[model samples]
Target: MAIRDAGDQPAAGIYGLSIETEPMEAKLAKALPSGEGWQYEPKWDGFRCIAFRSDSSVDLRAKSGKPLGRYFPEVVALLADLPTPNFVIDGELVIEVEGKLSFDALQMRLHPAESRVRKLSRETPSRFIAFDMLVDTDGMPILDKELAYRRARLEDFRERIEADPAYLTVSPATKNLREADAWLSRSGGDTDGVVCKRIDEPYRPGERAMMKVKRLRTADCVVGGFRYERDSELVGSLLLGLYNDDGLLDHVGFTSAIADIEKPELTARLESLKGGPGFTGKAPGGPSRWTTDRSSDWKPLRPELVVEVKFDQITGCRFRHGTKLLRWRPDKKPSQCDFRQIGL
Candidate 1:
């Protein structure tokens, strides 16, 4: 018998391709280590997008490789009207307010109503904080080129475009690590973190080539079930789960970021999926080093939902802090959810 190599196989979707998804990701240790050769850039807090411009038609893809053109109509229009026809740019979709990035404003762009989205697009209009030039004017993948060269190409592409407020601008890199640290520190509410890239290294698409150092830690958890608010039919907390050695969903943590009004409906939906082993091996037991006697307050259900959660840390297979509900994952299966998704 021979052991299998998981790394030898390509990941599914666009991740399998040697293409950059989001220019700056929160995994900077690979790109920038202590006393190393690297160029650091401010990590913008916004949507991760890949702008694909093939001739006149333009398509904006989200970090999940989903078509984001419909969600961000204004960006699609701007990309279509760009000077270059065929080019792929990896960047962040941000909204600027008073010379600072505004993630709250960017969140408004996710409206399902096209009319409202178009209205907000005109009112608060988004900007493309382009950082990487994957496909140059020649329509060739520059993944083999050094970071310095690719950045220069990105700069040239920006110069060719008309400085329209609708298009905003591109993000520039800082050679100084101290300055990058300042950007990471004073980023406050605007910046997400700092991304450091090796100047001499080539873009290793789908690989952790560059490095990102975020101010806070976050993790993606499987929503095994949800608990209702006391005395109310509203969802209070989402029961989080992680897979264990026996290939079973195990209760890990919980998130209670559900809104006041939506909780009622959400709880009803969650109650419908109750029963069965919500968690298998090492289920959430009583008080330990991290949690207290309040563990009994939580309720379990059949694992059916998956959600992306943002947390500060993890201790004893549980979240160190309460997580914020980023979004629902109807497209992702519960089995796909696991603790391995957490980046080291």
Candidate 2:
């Protein structure tokens, strides 16, 4: 395999990476297709990092080709202490809080201040879960090698060099269909879903060659509120909510899948139901630094309308992303829309 630079030019000299290497990518699939050629692993919900440890240095590279060494110093230190003289391993940086994987803690490590990063590194710390090997112990490039070979080498390295399983360990893999389905079924909080790869397929760097099947489930949500377009009365997005155990409607997420023609009718219907106490449980608007300008500008509505939406995952008691609006569930009652569907 001919490795190329960012400019698409052929890489110079040896494959000795000096803080540079494009990581292989994966494609998203709705379902994991069955076959004997498939290898499945849990899709960890954390920063994807590719570690390069040389004789003199060790570097952690993110999926977007960004440097992560400054943020995750503890991981760098662990990589430096590895028994291997030099090698490249692909893995994820995860921070666990209270026995559960915390993505928020991983995000907090991206502090600009070195002091803050250092503090968090000592306080919470991070772990590296190796999944693939792009460079072998002999310092030979293995981009042309198949997934089965790379996976075996990666596992061997973990068993040999990664003596301490606390900070560095190889992710578990399975080829059994029943076990793969179990991973997908229980994917949340820590594990995002299951990633299936063809054992015979070579790692295609910067390409979506591997397939990923995330946790996708549908929920009937109460349309408790909505946000109007800046200049028009049309609906920008439908605010979604689910009743908590205390009978309080909590704003989980929203969907902007309204058709242009149906907007007028939807807007009118929503306008009629405009009222207070839309979200009794965890209402929107807070000291969140990551909010949009319209985050505080949602129009509250009567908890009467219900919608069926498909969502991938829920994190921090909210939808990880905007749920896809499936249809207006007129047959479903808003009272029926509860967190029970998500088993929350």
Candidate 3:
């Protein structure tokens, strides 16, 4: 099953020894694309990397087009030692902590200090989860090949060159929609979501040609506060809050999807309810220098308004990103928006 190294050097240009191929991307979708000709894979929650190896060169590039080999020296060594040469692979750079994938540990590898990077690599070595094959050992660029054939070649390559489990892993793919849904339900922690691609689609670099479905769950939260647009009197974002175990209202996240036409009215309404309690449990403290202009103009509110919003992921008792306002829930009381709804 080994792909023969037709030449000592990689193919000339982007997929060559000096690999610089842009990784393919996926589009966010509310639901998985249905019907036939779709292959699903886990959307790994780590840095996206494209790995390449030639006769004497092994390079890893982050999705940001930055060099990753300096930070992931262990991965570089593993790729260098592999028997198969002149190949490029698209994958995620992940590190496991106590049998669970740790995205934080992977992020810590990006330090400028070489010593720090080396220490972390030794403490929690990174693993490349190969999801797709871009170039073969024969130094042939297969970016134009259909995914069905590319997957077959990748599987074949895996069979021939069994990578070390400690430093590398082959990401699993399936055609079953049920399995993908199961993965989506389990999205959080190590898994972020599920990625779906057309079976016959060729890799489209730097484009959202593939589909990704994330877990979008709804929550009823209290509009504990609101932020004004940097230069306008309109509402920019609504600070959401929920009661903790001790019955203290904690700011969980924010929603900023208020329509332009409704902003003036909503702003006036929110202004009238100002200065009761922004967040009792944990307030939006003084802004850091890095705070965005919009986030820096927040105002404490009465915490009397209740709103329903949709969120994808939560971490450290806070929403990972800004939520989308679904509707105002006057029927649901703010006290009812408790921490019990979310499983920590």
Candidate 4:
């Protein structure tokens, strides 16, 4: 994949996609089968990063190919200060406190001020838990090599690097399926799910070369305002609304994991038909049971996008978990995004 030029654009987080980036998805298995070709590992709950190091310069990019260097200055400094400075690595960016991953600390890295970022870098710094070796010290891509070989190379590199609890580390993997299953079940803390990869498979960059299993669930939502991350950009999140008999677009939920990456572009095309009373009935009123004064954060848009979110659970009408971001259906009208989809 071609390297994207990192400019002033917001580092692609959940809403953006890297130009060469492929969505990481899993193929559903009719039944969980055991096989020699498969190797399972604990899926981590953290940011996906591709670290590019060239001599003294290091760029930590998000899965969306956005430069994450600013958000993680300590990671950049650590990578630049590494023993080998000309290798590219793929890994998860996480913060482990008391041996458990802390995603809240990771989210704090998204601040806008450089001074604050630098300060936080010193205090509560981040760690790069490497899992794959994309490039070797010779500046050649090694993604075509088998997983066993890559694991050996990664182990060697980890051994050579200076250990900094806040900046760099290695992610451990187990080949035992039961152990992997155990990690999947131990929730409540930080384990996101389980990822199964082929031991002999070569690193298929920009491909869904692995299988991910998460505890899947679903929710019903109302389509509210559709905000574009940027002007002319595709819809970022479908501002979800719920209704009462009075008829209004109430700020209730949002579905961002629309599987259709290009769906937002199509949604923009349909905005021309937006002027009608999108949500009629009792719209979102004051703060709900979970929110505070932020109730006003919502905006009213023409109700035209309806989506069913295969989510985990709900705190209220809002998803208490990170949504999988499924695909968009033009076939389903806006009004179809309703409470019936909400799990009982």
lDDT of each: 0.68, 0.77, 0.78, 0.61
Using alpha carbons, what is the TM-score of model 4? 0.61
Q: lDDT tens digits, residues 141-161, model 2? A: 887899999998888787788
Which has the higher lDDT value, candidate number 1 or candidate number 2? 2
lDDT of 3 by residue, 47-66 (tens): 78888777657777776555
Q: What is the lDDT for 273 in model 4?
A: 47
Q: What is the lDDT of candidate 3?
A: 0.78
Q: Can you give the lDDT of residue 139 in candidate 2?
A: 87
Which digits, one per residue and each the tens of the lDDT, describe model 4 over residues 1-344?
A: 12222334433331122223432323323223366777666667677888777665556667555567888876776777777766777888887777788777776777788898888878777778888877777666677789888877888888888667456767768777777777768743666567778879888755545776655543335466655543434555556665543444556555555545666565665466456565465444433343231333334556665544566556655566445544433323344344433421
Off by over 4 Å in 2: 1-14, 217-344
Q: Using Cα atoms with residue i matched to residue i, what is each candidate's TM-score against the true structure? A: 0.75, 0.63, 0.63, 0.61
| Residues 192-231, model 1: lDDT tens digits | 6788788888876545566677666555567776655556
RMSD over all Cα atoms, model 1: 8.0
TM-score of 3: 0.63
Clashes of each: 3, 0, 0, 16
Q: Quick one: best TM-score, which candidate?
A: 1
lDDT of 1 at 279: 73
Better of 1 and 4 by TM-score: 1
